[model samples]
Target: MNIPMFTLLVGIPLVSSPVVYLFGRLTTRAQVLTRQGWIVRLLALLAVVATWFPFINLWLEFQARGRRMFFNIESIWLQLDGISFLLAAMVLTLGTLAILFSGRYMAGDFGEEKYYAMLLAMIGLMIGLGCANDLFNLWVWFEAMAVSSYLLVAFYREQPGSLEAGMKYVVQSAVGSALALLGIALVLAQTGTLDMDQIRLMVGTMDLNKAGLLAAGALFFIGFGVKVAMVPLHTWLPDAHSQAPSGISAMLSGVVIEAGLVAMLRALSTLTGFALSWGWLLLAFGALNMLYGNLLALQQSQVKRMLAFSSLSHIGYILMGLGIALVSGQPAGAQGAAFHLFTHMLMKGLAFLAVGAVMYALFHEQGIHRPLVAHDLNGISTRYPWVALSLSIALLALGGLPPLAGFMSKWQIFVAGFQSGNGWLMGFVVFAAVNSVISLAYYAPLVNRMYRRVTATSVKKGSASISWTMQLPLLLMALAVVVIGLFPSLMNWLTEPAGAALMSIFR
Candidate 1:
């Protein structure tokens, strides 16, 4: 009954997705609608938890077997390393919570079964992309992730905005994939192998034709940029993240785009290998992404859409960490990037879920027509205290206020910036700091709606109560954010090892 753990890690959800879908479909015939939802939920939970074991098993093996990278499938193929394990931890943890949040958010939707299937499938694909050892396999996994995410974005097909956003996402994604494939073809032509290490070694050489190499590098960078939603390429995100279901918003902002960065990291490792020139280019874009995203976010009235732009700004922080990592070969920047990814995923996921809770209480169950804005959310702190508390914590954290999850990660990135020994790096750090303040410009209105000022009004009583199923997830994430901020050291193990291991590849 023993299965290759790697296969188990990837297979559990891929296999169980169908089972959950069919079970959900078959159970539709049952008279008890309530039981049907819980049944599907239980199955999805088990599947996610099963996939999560790879991280736990990896830690045990590292302790017992003392290996940095576990070649679960051996050297000729996909492997699991510290970085892969760390990212998998984020993907599965958030994936599970988002699904749980969906229980109430999607309670009576007709397409609930398909939602389960697609969400689970997306998580598995992301894990596969992170573990992939060769360029071709990484591309395959990336494509799968893209397709599933597009479907998930447009899951509420009845909404015209949802359909429009999904079309834009897929079309842009296809163009990105084509450029990625072209880059892969060029690498294969030059190196005669799809192996990442060989590609890196070949491209790293001085004798390779510089002209052809640069063109391939450009294609790969632009291609991955589309997924990472790097500013100019980021138009699809605000719509996709906002129009999709709130649960999907959490996933999209939380881990889906980070998956693109993960693939980009793999591509960069194999194709460019610490090319300082490319790192400088990333540095420039990091600054622009921060400025552009925050400014636009200031104009957003829709809650989810505002968070969507905020996500674009956070990507700037992650990229800044990475830019320093590549340009200066500072492991601190990479470590900070990993930390930001972990913290941002939790913070953003919680923020979306909290918003979802408000929407659930206000729109879904109560049928209020209040626009999704701060004005409408006035006196919310008194009404839905749980949602208000969680939402407020998420907002402060996103704003990089101290003593919260967001501040610690951003501080680390800034410290890493200072450590880079380049005065120019300070300019990037300052620009980021300025953008952080700019971000506060938008987050303030939301905060005001929650606690700052409220005029008593006779609104419907008992209208904003959220179910415990949704409340618990929001509270758990809020607690985690506080705990992590108070003791950032909790993540030092994973972040340090993941950063160090990946950087060692260059040395």
Candidate 2:
């Protein structure tokens, strides 16, 4: 028997979560500073690293055999294709880096073990979602990811607003999940199938109730839209992202929402008439998200809150590409969306980790954890040169500046939009372009502040230095952002096939 690569890919971390918790329970806070705590930290990190073997093997197998893989064991169906492979790679790469950074950044924090556990579980569930070939399995993974993330958001239970944010997140997510489940029920009732490929075939061939399909589409849009942070449904994001620990914030802003969009795309793919039913709506919402999110981000002085809003704007960029794909039936839009998803993970993940490093340094200096304001970063570059530099790179890339990962990704999306050749969609693309420039209004100023001189009152009296564990992820991600920008073709092998896989459902 093969090693069950897909199963192990998700199982490694999922199983490790409890083991880490058990080990964590054995160590006291003081013991955590000692060898005992290091044991727990290593356990968490090694579990994440261990998954790499299976992932690499799966990728190699995928390449050698063909473009796809499928598994059926114990009645669970798993599909591995370009889309799942791309998403799983993103989840594993970012999850590993975030957990590694946590080894240092989360050190000595209470329940440090639980933090690692939840993070791993969330990553595992996300990967499961990417690979799920059944509707119910996808929802299970989605809900499980949400539950684990909720706990993470409220991790600092004693913090003033952490619990409040968690409450809001859970409530909204529960509602969204309910709506999504209802959508699934409708589909299952009409077609008598939970398998995505079968559902696609049935919908295409059978004359199902048109009204039920329309209702399913609406339900799914609203359900997944909340996670995608589409304007009207995005109320929970800023609070949740701002309240979560910095590393978790990076995961949430970076890959979690991207996973939600994938779930939405998969569900929508099973139904017909997406171009007529949802394309225009997605375009309108995409425009709103870009403008509204950018405008809000511009007004934020708090660092994490600003980044939270920025994620929404970037989500808008991605949705516009996907929307164009649906409307025009072109693969370029989907390809661009897929490419941008990969780059956004790198750019935003770097940004949050870099910001987290600063906060970690600040905590050591001040003996307290507090929200970081942009103004506090003034003159920070003089002391924490590497962190300051990495943050700047992240900010510039996010603003879609040239020769950076963000630039290339955004360029692909814009080109996809233009290629639609529909005057109206072309106009929407132009609007997205203007919003991209508008985003820099905030991004540029933040980068500028990092280099400016600070007043004596604003400066910390003690030297603030970041640990190498945290610094390594920052540099690695920053390098990726720069390298990918300059050489976009390097990722084409993955992005092209992933795009084709996604568009295949349409055909």
Candidate 3:
């Protein structure tokens, strides 16, 4: 309930990143858990755990107060508005799980110390982005995340391709940041306030300068669009996702993009009183992303690249939900978007972790490129059954199959779309459903390669000793996927109230 609790969640990781970099310089360890790596990992993990305590406390506080926002921490960061207590909780939860899953994924890497540090730093930035109620502060954190992410993507600096991907990401992100800053300037020029709550209040009273508002809206959309990888601006995503470390890939696809979306939603909520054109623009972009992403993914041969494109497609669905909420001025679509955001995070995180396991095993033999024929997976279901099973569940959920978290969230989005009675938007939702089936065409091959295909020569099994630190998160996420799928009400309870709070920003 105190600012220290929220600050600790963010500050610990912000401080740990540089510390890990320093450790890397002083230590001669090969594996992350060896030499100074263990201590760094412990501290990073502890920082995550410490952050979780406040989230728990906040949850309790929310229950008692019957208020969605709590722990309002304010200071002179960029503007007067402080962070959202609930969004902070969500960021901490996802960031902790991401780091935990990285344990095994990053094992025996050369730059483990640096890897953990960047990761922790990413966690800190995400918390700041989520918590910041000031648009200027949000933009700062947004750019910070962009820089950290570019570094992480190119962490394998020795690899030319990785460096290239990182450069591409940086260029695109810089353009986006510039646009966002311009939008912020425009908003400030018009409203004389940078605080999101204050902006929302002034938006209605301000003169309706159509040209300026539209330009400002376009600027904000382009900025967030680049991060969200909306169609026509998503060129950097596949390259970055394909080249980045598996753990970084997970975070990128799972949470980082969502942070951008959250910021966009916050900005949109603030500007709702101005016009409905912004909502229309978001809907158009969402439809384009869904169509283009699926079409591109259908052609990808690389596993990671396919996942990257799939991520783009799924983000379309979230945008669709947001668009619907804005167009109808109803909370259902926003709630659906929020729920889907969480479900997508869990499902994609699990999927990437599973892919990491496969890649790790393959690295022992050839590399990620070798075709996984039927015989290659012989007895994999028997030996590493847990990994195999988890991967299967993740893939299925990602395909939007029922009784999984993915399906539950998507169903909510679809219901909201249909309820809006907007014919064009409903058509977009239908197209998204079709894309879901298209996704299955790509995902099914992995399952077929693992279970149904028969190999002549058996491949070697992965080491039986998976670290508890890593396995626990995967197992929990896998279980969560199924649990939320079966019981959608749990997310409904969380997201519905969050959506209500967002809507209140307008009222």
Candidate 4:
């Protein structure tokens, strides 16, 4: 797993799709494959594990070399550099845990093979998207990930809302893709090159007019904002997240949405070289996202849907940091954004996985259709203390409670906000601080509900036990959250380099 062979990070997952498909074919026969789904799960786990080593090595090289080019295509259409390397690491880590959690979370289900393959495909596609060095390369991986995710969202087609969720996700993504392609076309028309490096050169030297620049920026913003689920572009996220399997939900919220933000950042970082004036616009949108997303999340009764809206607000926090970076010319803002993205993944992943554990336990014992209402958590702590504790930790972290990972990340964003010392940015900083308080309003109640005592009539008892496999991922992530919270320097070590790399594109 040397830096030289780091392209294997993407390659391993690509090769895994078919190998998983082959083994999935065997799951139908008892003699050939265990009825317990050990084959497909193991192959998927191995593929996930395989994706991580290269990332760890690439990360080390990146820290030591500070922008080492690990691997690339024939002409470097997709290249592994500091920015892509860390994103690839996040995708693989969450992807591995999602698959492992699914092994137990989705056991004994029909069409398990196809389900597993789609998960692997998503992991591979997201990894490729992270490392893509050009806009067109990103578009390609995006279309692929959209296709797989559409299927993954509809994985439990027999269930009531799965098909609708898949359809909505596809329609929204297709619209975004159309707008994204237009943005790419605008760039290609002006620059005559899709390479980010060359785009930088062209933007600096060419006479690309203001109108053309603005149009391209708007199209890219609207397009990628759909996936980021910002306010006004956010309708699709609630249903898709609330309906999708929890393991898949983790990917969608944890890394898949961030992929959109990263792609937009890549394009903007290059376009900003042309003196693009998107700073004020970014601040406006970021503030709106924080205010709107948190307000709506406060009203949700469904557990997953609440998490979904909160995700919209979390993205807002990251956007605010990024906006501050672009507007203020301070790299620490970018560092704060990157730090939030990284830590947010762990928190959301744990939340989704733990919630999924509850869903899985209830799905087996309930006689009929089971919806994921907050009421389902009534006195859950009395029954499943570990699940309740893990879920509570994640909720607290995301709510920006002190002595948790989310607090440190949010603190960085706040620092970045005011560092500019501009009147408008300072106003938004205070506004975001208030919005953070609004966010805690919802998370606190849910944690309290989970720990409260329940009357027998109010709480439905689950007959099946949640296995160690399901609980382990949640506990591990919770522990990681605590460790990082205690040692906040981990944020600086990982994200400062990434932030520096992002800023270097313009400098």
Candidate 5:
């Protein structure tokens, strides 16, 4: 039987998840555990790859038709528009590389079968959340993704830090979900419908309860703010990102938080006049996030923990672009935000995966799995030249250095702010630029340590070869950062439409 594009997009991974577990069960009885794990990993990778077809087809259709498409059943709507397509594509691409990296990274870990299963489930749910057009259904997808991710975060149940981090993540996420649900309930009570389009029309035409709508908007902001790691609501991120497996770390910092941003944007679109009030609120929060994230990262000695904090600062940049877009209705701001979202997934994903490769090498060489301190990377360039190079590129790009994707992405946002001709917004743009320079204080040290000389007192640099599986993803992403940096126009096809889609709400 033929399945709808939306169903197929969500179904491929969800359906493959269980089948992978059953394969694990069968392989256990028929083969050795090592072989069984490889089989499971292979199957999981194929399942993620299978998702590409539907996404590509849908994207082609959108490009050719140049319009949004909807799939409706009663009040439940799953729509394919520029933003949804961009987000879905991000989820699949990053999810695929993370899963592939997992093949070697998670090979001997306990519960290999469950690891792949939960990862796939989270990917599918994130896609659903992006495409969902009904408020209640969006919440359902959000919760489902949270459930799957919580398990993955605590996959190393034997480790105290892992369990502690997972508990923090689940508790904070549950409360955020509750707030979002409450906001949805208020929206439903106000309009008697959860359909976003219907609510938009009702809110625009009807004499609604302004007080009630404002309350819902506030709730939505705080609820989604937790996941976006916006300052003050961002306490849960450092532990969750640092404690989880490196592959999961890439997903959390790279795509997952961005998904939260998209969800918040979609929710806000349903509430008329929210942009006028919330737009400046985003700018204030953006500035706070930048300062908070940068200062905290400077204090971190652990590599992953530092990277986790840097994510907050990058999120702040995206928020600034989005804020400008909302307040001034300039397509440049929205476009910059969209472009940065794409660039960040590459830059950050490469950083984590490259660092994870070093961790993996050390584990195999020294039998240690503890958190890697930044100093531990000293003289690593001599032992692992390729990985050292990859990590340096990632760090430099993330620091917004010239001739890297990060530089171009930040440039776009700065240009957007200046083009608005608002003196205050332009000042924020200067603040963001200075923060970008200050960020290198921490980023540069990590790169410096990698190439520093190994002394008699320094940690041992063992000869542990990084497998092709891990190195492949790192190299590919590093190339992408350079290529995109050189050719910024290459991504306009995706970012332009997304910006247009976002502006549609304002019109």
Candidate 6:
């Protein structure tokens, strides 16, 4: 049967999630294929590959048609907008990489069936959230993603910290979802429509006597703020990221928060009159995140928690770009945000995967009791040289060094701020650059530990053979960071259509 590209992106992962569980169970029950675990691995691999087809089709379609404001494939079950298309493509790409990485990461772990199932389910919900055009539909998918993530965060149910982190995540997300629902209700009461495009048009014709728009905007911002883990609302992030599986942590830090930002941007697009106030709010939060996240990261002894806090700070940079887009009304700001989102995905994913490799080597020797100090990872460069190299590249990219994807994105955002003539925004961007330098203080120590420090007696023997499943994702993401940095036109072409789409919403 034929399906639209949008439907396939959403459906394939949603459908395969259950199938993975069933097939995994079947294999276990029969006891005939225990030795051939590769079969189940291949099946999971195929599911991820299937999801990529739609993005390929999307690229082809964009090439055939000029970068228009919108190109949609609408049906009873699925709807696609240009903005949704770009975000969905990002979700799919990251989802595929995460799943591929997990195949190796989870190889020896029990409950592989459930792990793969939840992974696919989260991917499906991410696609749903990205492509949803109506407020209610967006909320539904948002909750779906949240539920899956909560379960995934606590996937190691035996670990008390994991369970506690998951509980905290769910409770905070529930509160955020309730606020979003209230905001949606207020908007629907005023405009009698849930469609984003319709709401944007309706806002222009409505009276602003009661400040209902502002109230709704505040609610929406608070709701999505929690999702993106903006300051004050971000209590659950460090705990969850530190406790969860590394692949899931990568997914959470890399793509899930980006999806939340996309939702907030969509909501903000509906209330153009409040753009200045919202822009200031975004700017304030972004600045706070950059300052707070990095400084807190410096204090953390645990490697994963440090990275989690760093992720929070980088979210601030992206939000700054969004704020510029709103205040300056420039496509360049939006384009920069998109480029940053893409590069952050690769950089963060590789970083988490590197941590996973370290954990895999040390889990038996040290158990979870041994703290992961910079010194603990000493001699990893000698043992797993490729992994060490990949991790170094990822860290340098995260630090926004030249000839890397992160640098390209950061440069564009700073240029866009300058072009917009927003002195305050430009100053904030400069502050972010300073924060990036501060971040290097923490990140550089880890590299030094890996490459330069002498191995201690506590260090364990590293794995002799790195699995293809794990290595493939890191390699691909590392290469992507370099490729996109060298040739930025590829991302610019993809993001132009999306920028046009948001611009049309205002028009």
Q: Which ten residues in a row have the lowest lDDT in candidate 5?
A: 455-464
lDDT-superior candidate, 3 or 4 = 4
Q: Sort by lDDT, best first: what order?
A: 5, 2, 1, 4, 6, 3
Q: What is the C-alpha lDDT of each candidate?
A: 0.84, 0.88, 0.75, 0.82, 0.89, 0.81
TM-score of 1: 0.95
Q: Summarize candidate 1's per-residue lDDT along 387-504 as a digit string, tens digits.
A: 8899989999999999998999999989989988899998899889989988988887787877766733422443757889899999999999999999999998778877886676
Worst 10 residues of 4 by lDDT: 455-464
The candidate scoring highest on lDDT is 5
> Between prediction 2 and prediction 5, which has the larger lDDT?
5
Candidate 3 all-Cα RMSD: 3.3
How much is 141 displaced in model 1, in angstroms?
0.6
| lDDT value for model 3 | 0.75
Candidate 5 residue-wise lDDT, 394-464, digit = tens: 99999999899999999999999999999988999999999999999999988888887572123455566
What TM-score does prediction 3 earn?
A: 0.91
As for candidate 4, its clashing pairs are: none
Runs in model 6 with CA error above 4 Å? 29-36, 67-79, 208-210, 364-371, 462-464
lDDT of 3 by residue, 155-193 (tens): 878788898999999999999889988988898888888
Off by over 4 Å in 2: 29-35, 455-458
lDDT of 6 by residue, 1-507 (tens): 867675676788899999988878776656766655555667777997888887678667766865532434453344455677777777777777887787767774667788888888888888778766778878888889889899999988988889899999999999998998898889888888988777877787767434888888999999988999999999999999888888899999998988888787777678767777877888899999989999999999888888899899889888888778777888787778777888898899889888777776666323443335667678788777878888888888888888988889988888988999878888988898898889898888888888898874455453445677778888888888889889988787667777667655544
The reply for model 3, stretches above 4 Å from the true place, is 1-3, 23-26, 29-36, 68-74, 77-90, 364-379, 456-458, 461-468
Candidate 1 Cα outliers beyond 4 Å, as residue runs: 29-35, 63-67, 70-76, 367-371, 455-464
Q: What is the lDDT of residue 160 in candidate 5?
A: 96
Over the stretch 116-199, how does candidate 2's per-residue lDDT look in tens digits? 989999988998889888888889989999999999999999987899999999999899989999999999999999999899
